[model samples]
Target: MTEQNVDLGKNPRANRIPWPPLLLIASIAAGALATWVWPLPWPGINDGPAHGVGLGFGVAGIALIVWAIITLRKRGTTFLPDGTATSLVTSGPFARFRNPIYLGDALIVLSIAEITHSIWFVAAALLFGILVTALQIVPEERHLESQFGDAYLDYKSRTRRWI
Candidate 1:
């Protein structure tokens, strides 16, 4: 695939503080609040199954997130997208996908929506993914491409953005 062509030298929004984690938190809060505002029931599934599904997805998502953090920590790299990258992580979860954390974020969003059984929550989840990808992931990728050059290009070529 062709790389995204963005002018880093003249970009005006590069100095802004990153808010990906805050966005994730807001998404979760919005979901929970939405459940309170318009709590709905699953069409055919029982409460037990719903809870089980939510718990399953939530735990797995949490685990994935933790794993990604641990990986970054073990490698002594910055998890913050806005910061400088210290290493080109390509092991563990990184070996599988370029963005395990983002995948985990999506999963967590899914789990929250599932648990709440709220259409509004699901909408928030979708918005969460879209916003993160556009605001955080895109910038991070651009930085990685610039910082790591051909190495990142090779990694990006081999790995999927979100698997």
Candidate 2:
């Protein structure tokens, strides 16, 4: 709304809302909560191939999350987007996409929809994606830009935000 309400700090979560946990909550709410709150007319997929594909996506999403966390550990930086940054991470899954963990979350949410065959879950997942991108990722990116300056700009120029 007003410039006074805006925060352009390198660590923008000064308001105390952590990004990673918020994203985790969003994904869970999107998938799990929606699954229960709005049960599908036809729950569960019977086809073997479809189940395999859904399982594969879910597993891949988990793998990406694991890899991203490992990379963050290797970089000596916390995974929380709003946390203090020890280093500019640009390796492993990060080389491919800036927000691998968030991408993983999206995949997980999507996988839930696929596995459950729930259009409502899909809607929730989509809402999760949109909300995270707007409320979290944008601010985190601004924080990074403030923190890392040209280096972050260069990386932003090079890497896709999501892949």
Candidate 3:
């Protein structure tokens, strides 16, 4: 039997616990809480214009997420962390970032940092990136590699994981 035919079933890693969105939420909450309890005196621009820019970043992030979702649904693919993807999405934001949703999440975190004037949120964004990469992206990549074989490999070769 061919390698691709080994397990063309539901994603093997779908059963893993601690969903990606939950991880992101946890990271953001932790950062916000930390900032509230122990505000970091980081010296940087976090004023009216900065907050406005932060809001803009948040809008952009939300827009990216919505665009991705629309593209995925149109392609008949799943966006849920545990749901099986029906196809390898390679258009829209996927063309630029392999994990646009995660990128959006990062942008939202940055938004929080700027809006709240807290460096803790910046750290939170980084932590979220590392955690999601380890807990979600890696598994999803493996699953996609198994599901789409060379098509996915080729896409991975051309697409950036995050941008």
Candidate 4:
């Protein structure tokens, strides 16, 4: 993709701050607050099956995140969204998904929702996904497309954004 092809100027807020972790934290806090103030009855949240599902998802999410981080580090690329990526990494978890870390984050949010028995966390997860897409993923994609050009585009085409 050409520089002109990617509209980096569409969201000014995206480039200003490190939003991913902050957004995740904010979502969790909001969910927790909501749960405290107005706890909704989630029927199966306390069940053994629900806890098992949450545990499984949490493990998978953490594993995916760690794998992605290791892959980026091994390739000498910056995993931080705001940092300049030294290399276009397309191995390990990256081979399967362009945004494995973000996917992991999303999974962790779901895990939290299940573990905490909070319907509000499910809402938070949805909100977090939407906000991160607009504020982090879109900008990051534009930057990558601009920085890596056709190679990034090709990788993007072959690999799903989230799996």
Each model's lDDT comes to 0.74, 0.73, 0.83, 0.81
In candidate 3, the residue pairs with backbone N, CA or C atoms under 3 Å apart (3 or more residues apart, or in different chains) clash, namely none
RMSD of each: 5.0, 6.4, 3.7, 4.6
Ranking by lDDT: 3, 4, 1, 2
Q: Write the number of the candidate with greater lDDT, choosing between 2 and 4.
A: 4
The sequence of per-residue lDDT tens digits that candidate 4 reaches over residues 60-123 is 9899999999988887667777776556788888888888988888889889989988889889
lDDT of 4: 0.81
Those runs of model 2 whose alpha carbons end farther than 4 Å from true positions after fitting are: 1-15, 30-46
- Count clashing residue pairs in model 1: 0
Location of the lowest summed lDDT over 10 successive residues in candidate 3: 1-10
Which is the better candidate, 2 or 3, if ranked by lDDT? 3
Model 3 lDDT vs. the true structure?
0.83
Structural similarity to truth (TM-score) of each candidate: 0.81, 0.81, 0.89, 0.87
Write model 3 residue lDDT over 70-142, tens digit each, in one string: 8888887678888776688888899889999989999999888888788999999999999999888998898
Tens digit per residue, CA lDDT, model 2, 80-103: 765655567888998999889888
lDDT per residue as tens, model 1, 1-163: 2233344343323215666778888888887787787776745355887788887978887888889888887887767755656567888788888888877887888877767566666777788888888888788777777766787789889999887
Model 2 pairs whose backbones collide: none
User: Largest TM-score belongs to which candidate?
Assistant: 3
